[model samples]
Target: MATVVPEESTASTEVKAHEVRPPRKPSASQIAAARSLPNNNEAVWPAFTTKLPSSLYIDEDRFDEEHRKLFMTLPLPLAPSALLAEPGSFVCRDGFGQSVILTRDKDGKVHALVNSCRHRGSRVTENDEPAKGRLMICPYHAWSYDLSGKLMAVPRREVFGELDKSELGMVKLPCVEKGGIIWVKMDHEANDDFSHVSDELVADFDALGVADMHMFALRKHEVEGNWKLILDTFLEGYHVIRLHVQTVGPLYEDTVVQVDRLGSHLRQTSARVGFTKDILAQNEESVDDLRRVVTYVYTLLPNVAFICSQDYCNMLVMQPKGVGKTIVHNFMLTNVNPQSEKLRQKWEKSLELTDGLAFPEDFSASAATYQGLTTGVVKELMIGGMEVAMEHYHEMIEEMVARA
Candidate 1:
């Protein structure tokens, strides 16, 4: 018994609805087209509303910009005690490209130097093990360098004929061992002292018991993505629900995490909503009686993550391989106490699981984003309120990139 509306009225209503359509979602090709637009610095604040040119991620010009702007003057780490595990054990690798060499002198003093030798640029040490005692011979030629990067001997030194032997030593970089970690400054003009960054990070570093930690898991990964993109994944907790759905998603709350800025350094911790206590109580028999019950996350200046739990810690260093690639060094550290085998194993396993899935997930996500960006498909990326830390990070990059 319902009456039908008039055809003319129905047609008029349909026409009005058709006239009002929501904004169209931009396609990948559309995004690329948007990149052709002019540079808009105004879009960099809360959201970098305008997508940068795809070339920024793949072009040689953009890579050169990053090299000159960011990597040209990076700080170098150098400290014998920081790199030492036992009385005289040490290890080191390249801060930027492919290079690493470890040496333990006869006096129980350890020196970690770059692989390249001073005499005609030959690699001094092999990749197998730390060279013992003083003499280290270069692989390319018979040139040799002493423990302190001194020109110990050169094949047919007399034939060189009046060449200054003193000046023909390996080029040493500015480095320091602090809080159980070797830090090398990459910039030649970098300040000799690291008191500024150290003083700020000392308390947190001590809290992790870094002074007594030993390296257990040392691994490096090469991936296709900007180093910052990989770093950004670790800097915030906003992506857990989306990116780490199966792994860390259940452990952290997307909205309740904390982010604190210490100068150029960043520190953060996730609230477990009583889950940490629950996990501890369930595994009380396996965990030690006197261990920290809280999970801590910290990021030191430049690029280092000190993720520590009650039993052990993980130290990660991310180095930019190129504009679109990065090299990551993941280290497992434990307490000096030899009796904590059970506790150490439990902690190490937790870190292993977390680190294990993280890189793979991030690699996939970052590579996909890079493809879209490089293909000229996206004009802008939109980050929301939960990703405030990420926005802050990008803002700082903009400022640094724009300076000078």
Candidate 2:
């Protein structure tokens, strides 16, 4: 079951703040990016245009290559650490074409185990909900395993002569919890080195207090589009003013974003509508109110996009199911849990605005783009200078796929 935060009515008209950790000052790199953001009037088009073949989105061979080389091999973000914050808690996630059981042991160590039982191949956990217990009892034969994937009990063990419990533990994948996200490599033979999750990315997430945030809600979206096409939405701001004009466009500056590359990952910082260069000039050393003026979008290569706003962060894990299908797991994380009615209402409203209104706009655009490409009339898609981030993203993907 989904964890629920208790909401109580408050008599005070003023909003009471929830208990949270101290706000972190913007990192040096983040502050520098903020200072370098171009004003709306100073924004200029890119000097060159890049063209990507439509086959890249609709071709089965291209999709299969990416699936094997990138998605299967890399350390993909599975879920927020907050989801398994409590000891003995577990959550089942099947977004990456694999049923994974994420658990927090009594000692608070996180583990990613295959959901299949060692006995009859039945799923140990039957549903995708946050559950807590000492043992994960398989429904097939009541075979149970501990939170760390250690086999604990088996029914009628004497019936099976010389059963080896030690060798029958659940299969564990290479998992690491960093920057408040759980990352797991899907392929058993893939390299376990997590060097691809760079320190720069962790520092940025740490500065944003991503590790300590409370998970407000998580929802799964089945999008009728390629995963890369869905990711392209967050890589560029060119579509905001045009595509999101009715929803969130009025709050953003037109095509003015500061793009920075952190190894394979990418970070985009853009000023909000009322933002001015003077804000950076006043706060030279540190950005006291960074999210208020600037929106940070970090793309963790292959499958994750972490978008930061003033009150909460949106972590999107786009799992490609096919050339034309993607499963997007959206997680909304807040600095603190909503303890009062006012706070609860505030978060609910934010969730409704983004998930209900804004995200539909972005998702539909990706679907429409996919539909158009599938018709085969358009041989190539044009990438403008303002959307240079998309070019960088695609290049990084191609480079990773080329690796031996």
- The CA lDDT of each predicted structure is 0.53, 0.81
**Whole-model lDDT, model 2:** 0.81
Which ranges of candidate 1 are over 4 A from the true structure?
1-59, 76-83, 87-92, 98-114, 128-131, 188-198, 275-294, 337-348, 402-404
Best model number under TM-score: 2
- Clashes found in each candidate (C-alpha, N, C closer than 3 A): 20, 0
TM-score of each: 0.72, 0.94
- Ten-residue stretch with the least lDDT total in model 2: 1-10
**What TM-score does candidate 1 get on C-alpha atoms?**
0.72
Q: lDDT by residue for model 1 over 1-404, one digit each (tens)?
A: 00000011222222333222222232222122222222222222232332334565667777777676655554433321334555433344664654755444556444546677776676776544332444667878788777667787778878889978688876665555555656665553466666535454554454344665655556667778876666666666556766766765554343333455555565554433243434434432322211233334556645566665444566667777777777777666644433445444554555556567755676667667876777666755666655555555666566657872
Steric clash count of candidate 2: 0
In candidate 1 the C-alpha lDDT for residue 36 amounts to 29
lDDT, candidate 2, residue 312?
78
Per-residue lDDT over 130-244 for candidate 2, one digit per residue giving the tens place of the 0 to 100 score = 8989999998899999999989998899998999999999999999998898989887566679988888888888778788889999988899999999999888878876787
lDDT of 2 at 45: 62
Q: How accurate is candidate 1 locally (lDDT)?
A: 0.53
